[model samples]
Target: RKDALFEPPVSTFQPTMRLANVSGINIIPGEDTFCMDCRILPCYTLDEVLSAVEQCCAQIEEEYGVEVCYEIPQKSESPATPKDSPVVKKLSSAIYRAHGIQARTIGIGGGTVGAELRREGIDCAVWSTLDECAHMPDEYCIIENIVKDAETLVEFFSE
Candidate 1:
């Protein structure tokens, strides 16, 4: 079960395979090949999680007598944004004003431009309204949310 806090954090592994030529509908592919997109929780280091994945893949290779190859094309980890930081305080105030609710801070494993900014010693509040379909198939934006988010941004910028 998932809670709003994302307590203990969460990791995801999504594999995608593309088959070019399949002669028969019932026939399995001669070789399995896929890329894994792993969004590791911020609590774990890349080396630690990568080593674990390698060990698991080794076991899979031994069990199936097949080879497996995987590569990390890109990866980044960001330090947590301090809840009491000035930027956070400002954003929280803006959010509360625009939405008429308390603003809370939380961490997520998703990659964002904020990672780069944070690494450069800049603080930013990365947020969104509902949908939660980022980086997934059939992802779309809700117009209502866009308008509401604009209000939030206006509140932020006007501060």
Candidate 2:
């Protein structure tokens, strides 16, 4: 017997948070494999994103012998912003040129913790001095980048 009243249709609804999950396969035994996730923030433009992605891909290939892939969530649009923003344009450009890498900006179409904060009227920005080495089995941070990160934090707090 079919129970029409209790038969709810499978949801076609999509989620509202966007993310970039990265992973690497190890060709060697006993070496710690790699994986990480970046909770994306809203981006200002496509070109900015492209630049950042190019930088990331180049960096990963050089440093880890791997290529990172980007997966975009549904219904996202490329944002537009000034090409001269110090963080977006200048820093990314410098990183790419000096290291033969690429840096581009991208948007997260769905909501995130960061996005939720913004919705509650909190302002925020994100950056990293080194490749985000947050959660791999043998994860590590670069000393130089730590110093630079400290300096940047000081500068931010000063303002």
TM-score of each: 0.74, 0.31
**For model 1, where is the 10-residue window of minimal lDDT?**
1-10
lDDT of each: 0.77, 0.48
TM-score of 2: 0.31
* Candidate 2 weakest lDDT stretch, 10 residues: 3-12
Q: After superposition, how far is residue 17 of candidate 1 from its true place, in Å?
A: 4.6
State each candidate's clash count: 0, 15
lDDT of 2 by residue, 1-159 (tens): 222211122112234444333344434333333333333323334456568768977998899886566554333332223335555555455555444457545433333354455556544334457765564587888898877666655554544
lDDT measured at residue 35 in model 2 versus the true structure, 0 to 100: 38
Candidate 2 wrong stretches, greater than 4 Å: 1-113, 132-135
